[model samples]
Target: MPNTPERPRRISVEDQGPMLVEGPVEVTCADGSVAVSDRFVVAVCTCRRSRMYPWCDTSHRRRVKREENTEAEDGPAS
Candidate 1:
């Protein structure tokens, strides 16, 4: 059998969300620790708001404006 060069992994960046990367991945943190995921695709947190750290838990979608919440609670201004 002949050996071939491995193809580069694909990564996708989202403007307002986590960066998607082709996985079975290993993530190294600034603290010199590593997180591993065997999923086919992984969502790496970019907003730094994920409770799961290196992995995203959809926390970004829960971000809501304070004003929007207040308006909704106030029954709309006339």
Candidate 2:
């Protein structure tokens, strides 16, 4: 027999970035290792800028905010 799966608090996709995941989760890798964040819902970093990978440190916001394209081609002019 196996234990019931724990339900996450919330999971959502950012408007322009990685999927936001919260709540307790049992993450696993190809190496057959597993980890549980068990901590209260955390803003997982989908943008991949955190020193702590897979966890949100609000760094993504900064990365995304700096998307000032210097050579953006002219779109339909307003």
Task: Report lDDT (CA) for all predictions.
Answer: 0.86, 0.60
TM-score, one value per model = 0.72, 0.49
* Per-residue lDDT of model 2, residues 21-68, tens digit only: 565666564477765676655556666687765666666664345666
After TM-score superposition, the amount by which residue 26's alpha carbon in candidate 1 deviates from its true location, in angstroms, is: 0.3
Q: How close is candidate 1 to the true structure, as a TM-score?
A: 0.72
The residue-by-residue lDDT of candidate 1 on 1-78, one tens digit each, is: 222359777899998899998887889899999998889999999988999999999888865665558677888799
The candidate maximizing TM-score is 1
